[model samples]
Target: MPTGVAIRDPREQLFNAAERVLLRDGPSALTSRAVTTEAGCAKGVLHRHFTDFDAFLAELVRDRIARLDATALLTSAGSGVVSHHLTVALTDLFGSVAVAIVSLVISRDELRARLRRTTPTGIPLLTEAAAMLGSYLAVERELGRIDAGCDLHVLATTLIGAAHMLFADRTGTPPDGTAVRRVVDSVIVGALSTPPR
Candidate 1:
């Protein structure tokens, strides 16, 4: 009963459906039949778009990672201390996105290869996050809000990794907000503190 205008790009629709399935029931529920059924399309529609179920899953994961990177880019622009923005930004990154990544990483060899191929060799997300943290600290130092002469890059990496572990809770709910704030602020202060040389 679907006409050209009524029908969306099946590939796009399929990917969106897969994301919902992933968020709801996790990745194991993402078979071609399940995706097609969820998308309300023919089962053959999957194959018509992706090479196989694994390829489709890998593409889904790739699309998510790209979206996360785009989010970090737009959100980080003109943002303040990693304390405020980092937690929420990282909540998005290390939260659902990280879970999806771990799922794909644990899947079959070809899927793993596809993920690796889609991802750049280095983890630019971490690097960019750290750079952003450094910039924030550098600005604070200039403003007399904090002392300087600190290695912002190193501190940024530490904060990024720490944020991942701290906030990537398996439980649906996040941990205490104030506690997270203290941890992030402490790390920033400790790293950027102006100490006598």
Candidate 2:
């Protein structure tokens, strides 16, 4: 690990280093200097790949999103057990991508200086995750496993919001399976009560 001279291609090495830096140091450590240092590259390498800080952050988010999406896929379509998925997917995202997202969103200065341009305009991650839930709900609703009227939209929104809040530690504690289950079940049952005919 020689400084100023990288071992592998700087691009791959930097991306790998970015993940390591993000995990060990969180989103706050994702500066060009920090990432290059971690990757054993000169500071200019970041600029060579990305146009600016915003571009780098954007790439970081993209990197994280891909990983989370893969995780959600693995969690996969199952029993539509909200508690199960919540325990696995949301919690996992919180620890990983969501940590960076939350950290960026929480800090006004950081959000403006580093995140505003890079971060998506709205809850893209949540929307994606919710859509995952919505897919499950669609199946459940079709099978009559859950309520038909559950407004998958609302359920998705609620789940994403609750998940974000929980991950941000806004509640002062990580949300538990029971709580997630209860809310999800309530929505399902409510949706079920509506006349499907």
Candidate 3:
């Protein structure tokens, strides 16, 4: 057993266990039984906490999105090289756990509908990411790092779309940090105007 697993709230324990199962065995293996088994709790524990498996999954997805939002909040522009900051933020956002959760949600319609009903705005994670990226780019533009003429929304959307593909390419291992940085640099440079020579 892990250090904190035994002490945390039951909901958190279940969530963490579900994430572990998803990451270790992929989305198909993330059943209520698997989650409870990994959590070292009874099968009925999840039912007692959440309305059903879909409800639990919905809450888990929302919790993960909230965590990603918190991470985005830490990525302020002008604090570091904008491309590097953006790369790090995107990499964290598209991590293997996130990818697994997304895959599960896409394959499970009941969970998807549950999530849509529970979230206030019903906006998906990718849209939220794009919005965060756009805000970061706007701040960078104000600091003169990005071109004034560049459309922040379009650039953010493009970056998010590319990142989606990069993350979805689970053919073998994920793209390394160097590859992610190169892609971020290319995107940023293409969107920025040449400085005065």
Candidate 4:
């Protein structure tokens, strides 16, 4: 709001503001001005930190990707029910601004091109999400929980894709936990070395 007022962690502030705009107004409504206005900071603050709006958006997507935590998923490989762990992880992922961020990336050509320099292949948020699941699946395979011959890459991608669709478009509320668990269990059933729980 003020040109000279101190704002600590502008990048995080801007990122949060952008997420709000993206979630509330959708990708078409997002702009440097929109983000700055949402953040209550000067529009020049965005330019000072990023070469352009696309650059800022690229970092936002990357930052979201970095925040996808796989620790619980990885550690649950041998102990917890595989399908249950997967359900929780996928549900948590889609419950965030991820669906909106994915939509934002798809709507912006320049942003996508800029992201490609670092990502090189696949959509940024979705690809990283697939990788997170893949890593957990790999751990399960190592522990003999998942079938030896199952292609984890495909499984992981399928899970992310299916889960994304489930959470992508909705009116009032996210899909119920039972709905999410059904999707996770359906995708993971054939891959489990043991019978599905």
Candidate 5:
């Protein structure tokens, strides 16, 4: 890299590089050098864009969280099988770099603290996931798909936790769709007022 080579969207490039590093070599291999090298930019590029490496990581997680398609989930409330939608969502989320991102968050205290400033609650990815699922469940409840008195918060948490466990097994390939659907069905069974369609 040259001294004055302008890199378009350095932040995104750096974030993508970090994601590649995190996904390929795990959190332990991720560093300012690793990210900059992967981005094909100078180390100063990262420092100039972010307050620090942790700041970069925090922004990465936030970027990923922002990418989750809440609108699709929300709009699916009145139509498709709830479990099916959740199954696809969970599978897509964990199948990507999300599980690795979760690991990265857990490995770095500074990143966690920085994220806490914005996410002030549970783990970033999982917390937002639960909220997404919870929002979908709330819509379902209104549509009479689930029991009127169902506790959506609890249901959403259960679904996310259970689904996360199924996909967190990075030791092997992510669980197949059937496996995810099973977890979804088991967790949401008690609350369903109407049969899954």
Candidate 6:
């Protein structure tokens, strides 16, 4: 077997490798052999850890969602310009890696079913992202950065929906960080009233 990092967690290593493959080569290039090679592990290593490729993918998606959730929580807690923080969070989610995974899951029925089985109660990443943004907006509202009467859930969904479209666009060059920030800022400005002078 090939050797690589001395990390204790094989699953994490595999997940990281899989993510690299997805981002660098796109979803079609992702395979058990590719992941194991990227991780510098034996071909059977992935099977040893996960039931199969679909199960592994489901776990990977869940892990990424959990990471995004953590980021949202941290951003909400940090002291900074609310719009900047939100822009950063949404941009993170709209990266190539995320877009690739989301595209793969949507087009693959087996993987989608596996994911649904894995996460029964909670929403998928997109819905979860909207909820995270909504939670952050609620925090901003409490801090008087958002309008008191604004519908946070709707605002969050709208922002996420718009960002999703931009991220999922493949015909032209994807929006860069600055463009994403501008979109996020516009959403925030529209949702918030002017602060009392």
**TM-score list, all predictions:** 0.67, 0.69, 0.83, 0.96, 0.95, 0.80
Single out the weakest 10-residue window by summed lDDT for candidate 3.
Answer: 117-126
Name the weakest run of 10 consecutive residues (lDDT summed) in model 6.
69-78
> What lDDT tens digits, residue by residue, belong to model 2 across residues 1-197?
65544455666687778777766676666778888889877778889888876676666655555555544533444454444554565566665546555564454353344544444455535555677666766665676655655688787667677666655653256667566555545444456544221
Number of the top candidate by lDDT? 4
Error of 1 at 173 (Å): 1.8
Q: Model 3 over residues 53-110: C-alpha lDDT tens digits?
A: 9889989988887766634534566665677787888898887477777788878978
Q: What is the lDDT of residue 73 in candidate 6?
A: 52
Q: Write the per-residue lDDT of candidate 5 for residues 123-163, one digit (tens) a residue.
A: 99899988998888898899999899999899998988898
Model 6 TM:
0.80
List clash counts for every candidate, in order.
0, 4, 0, 1, 0, 0
Q: For candidate 1, write residues 70-127 as lDDT tens digits.
A: 4443354344554566556555566555655555456556677766664544343444
For TM-score, the strongest prediction is: 4
**Each candidate's lDDT (Cα)?**
0.63, 0.60, 0.77, 0.91, 0.89, 0.78
lDDT of 4 by residue, 1-197 (tens): 74488889999999999999998998999989999999999999999999988999999999998898889888788997889899999999999899999999898999999999888999888999999999999999999999999999999999999999999893457898899999988998899999777
TM-score of 5: 0.95
Clashing pairs in 3: none
Positional deviation of residue 175's Cα in model 6 after best superposition, in angstroms: 3.0
- lDDT of candidate 6 over 32-142, digit per residue (tens): 999999998887788988999989989988898787754555556436677677777888777646777787787677888877865554336877788888888888788
Clash pairs of candidate 5? none
Clashing residue pairs in candidate 4 are: 1-40
Task: Report lDDT (Cα) of residue 102, candidate 2.
Answer: 50
Error of 5 at 30 (Å): 0.6
